[model samples]
Target chain A: MLPFVFEWQWDIGHGVFMGLFYLALTIVSLGVVAALAMTFYDLYSGKEVHEEGHGHEDPWADYSYAHDKADRGEYA
Target chain B: MDDSKFWPKGTTRCKPVHFGLWMLFCLALAGWALVSAFLCLYKGLNQTNMNDYFAFGVWIVVDLAIIALGAGAFFTGFMNYVLRREELKNIINAAVIIGFICYSGAIMMLGIDIGQPIRGWFGFWHANVHSMLTEVMFCITTYLIVLIVEFVPLILENRQINKVPDLHFFAHNLHTIMIVFAATGTFLSFFHQGSLGGMYGVLYARPFAARGGVLIWPWTFFLFILSAIAAGPSFTTSIVMITEIVTGKKLTTHKVKMLMAKVSGSLLLFYLVLKIADTLYWAFVQTPAMGLSPSVYYQAPYGTWLLIAELGIGGVLPCILLLSPQVRESYWILLLAMLLNCFGVTMNRFVMTIQSLAVPVLPFEKFYAYLPTWQEWGISAGVIAYGFIIFSLAYRYLPVFPQETKLNPTTD
Candidate 1:
């Protein structure tokens, strides 16, 4: 997607397609960079270290554990 | 139980031994593909059934099929993130993973199919600006990157992986700006999906597939987009359904599946109407103007019955089945309709790639039959294996279905 690529055309078709291709690549690259920047910044700043809401805080809280108990002949 | 730590929070997974056995089976198929890929790269294209007349074989067919089916990622993203549909968020993660697998695997197959992996970059560095294939190469690769970016957060959300503070935060950050990547994916995918059709449509000399165009794009271009948009969600829903069936869990509610069905049915109706119109124009006006009858393209294996199956049975039936409230509410019937819709789109692509090439463009060039070699079959099997293995891992590790926890709640 570089300009130095020799097969590059100076026409509308090439301009439009190549333009869009580079644009997408740029957005993807920037998104990754932004994520890294924010992540590290969060680490440096000591932001609240919270776990994901789904099964993060207490794995044993899962309903499947109840199934395990029932399977073992213990009534729910 | 050994792998419970890896499972998404609140979720229960299959026994490690069972999961390991499934992985082993996938590995064997993958091994066949690797051997096929090695032979194709080392020996040459001759290892396959491709000939001069039948230049595009099962590889292209498989590639086109997966890429079209993969359109669910962008379309779903467009709906959830762009159109602001909250309910779709429940299923969008799975859609993204499927899209990533389909696109990336198709890229790998293309690398093998082109005979030389190293030279595949020439499509980018030395692009033919006017060629539809060139457009497809550029858009598909870029969209693959977007899919990866969209998928990164889900990876970081793995139960153990999310324990890392920085990685967790990074995943959170990515989610915040996901709409940008989703929009980019939608843009890139729209072109590649259409260009794939334009690749067949631009065969000005090939009367069966060629059509009049506006500026540079052809009728098949728009039709391909509609067909893809129609089939993509249905394919995703079918996969999710299969996953639910196998896992014996309600990954997402019937509401979400029904919503997807309604969307698919509407698009399928639009596609069928346009496709029927396109076929009529091609059969009566376009072919006659080129001094040929529709009979020229219909031979033994590639005959009118294929058209009947593609449109009447696969296309029309599914559209009706999905649209009816009664049929769609029944889980099995709805899933069957979605499956048929996907089959219809696959048939369309197969006809475009295989049947289009089957018809002789020149008077002296006779019609020829082509079947994929065992190596070609092996390569295709590899794509399937790759998709299965990756999705299996993702479903095991990541929080793919948000609704799973609520639907199948465990007693505390």
Candidate 2:
């Protein structure tokens, strides 16, 4: 996606495509970095762990606990 | 075993034995792929029925089909993130997961489809700006990255996974500013979808596929984009319905399904009009310019009936069925219409790839037909197997459908 890549060209097609592609990548990366920075700062400052609530089931609990379909439906 | 922990907390699933059998079936298909890979790598593509004339073959067809079906991810992300359609939030994760499977599978298949898998990088290193394949390679790879970025947040959002403070925060931030990624994906997808068709259209040597149009892109270029998007949502809906039937659970509300159908039908209507115009122009002007009658294009093995089936049975009928409110509302009719729509696009890609090669351009050239050998079938099966394995994993792990909890509540 970089302009310096061997396939990179000065044409409008490559310029526009690669330009927007990099832009998106930058935004996504920035979002991640910003999140990391904030979390680290909070942790270092000993800000009370922002635990929302105990009842809030971890979103991925459903994933790690089950491999087959039958086991997944036990609670249902 | 706590079944609820695995099946989205509340959704019903088939019995363990049945699920095991299904997994076994998938594994068997995957084994077929292993054989296909061995034959293709050792014996070469000659193992395929494809000859010099039909170099593209079924691999290209499968590639195009998956890419077209995968458009739902970009289109749905566009709607949910850019257009601010909140209801679609329910199914956006599923679309992303499916998109991931389709793209990764297509890319993997392409790696093998080329004569030299290791040298596939030459397409980029020895750049051909004029080549439509170059454009496809660029856009598809870029879009795959975009899809992965889009999927990351969902992966992080998994119940047990997001417990990590860093991942949780990252996912939340990513979701907050997802519009940038979504818009970029839409841009990349649009071009690749068009370029795939552009690849065929620019083949002036192949009159059956060539066309005149605005700068750079031919009419087929635009038509391919329209057809992919028009059929994409329907394909996604069909998949969701299949999952529901298999699991005995509803993952999306009726309204969401109806909205998806309406969007697909309207786009299909627009596409049909343009496609028909393009066909007529090709028949009346383009074909004759190359000193061939329209009827000459379709003979014997590939007869007029193929066109009738493509445009009439596959095209108009599905469009009409989907567009009408009565038919769209009826689950059976809507499902059947979507199936027909998927069939129509596959047929279109098949014709564009195979039939284009089948039609002889030179008077001395004889018409040729091809059938995929077991080896070729194995590779194709491999791609399908890959898609199934990836998608099944995503569904099993990720909270792909937000509406799941509401639709089929886990009664603790």
- Top TM-score prediction, candidate number: 1
**Model 2: DockQ vs. true structure:** 0.14
The local distance difference test score of each candidate is 0.87, 0.78
lDDT of 1 at B386: 100
Residue-level lDDT of model 2, residues B1-412, one tens digit each, is 4443544334455566766677788889989988887778878888888887888898899999989989999998899789988767766777887888889889988887886789887766665665787778877887888788878877776556666776666666566667877888898899899999988888999988999989888988999999999988888888888887777776676567777888888988999999999999999988888888987778778888888887787789999998998886677788889888888888899889988999888879987777788877887888887777777766765677765665566666
lDDT of 1 at B340: 94
What's the residue-level lDDT of A67 in candidate 2? Answer: 16
Candidate 1: regions farther than 4 A off: A1-9, A53-76
Per-residue CA lDDT of candidate 2, range A8-40, in tens? Answer: 668876665556546656765675576567767
lDDT of 1 by residue, B1-412 (tens): 4878888888888899999999999999999999999999999999998988888999999999999999999999999889988778878988999999999999999999888788888778877787899889989989988998888889988988888888788888888888889898998999889999988888887777888878889988999999999999999999999998899887776777888999999999999999999999999998988888999899987889999989988899999999998887788899999999999988898998888889998879877678899999999999999999999999998999887776667674
Error of 2 at B383 (Å): 1.9
Clashes of 1: 1
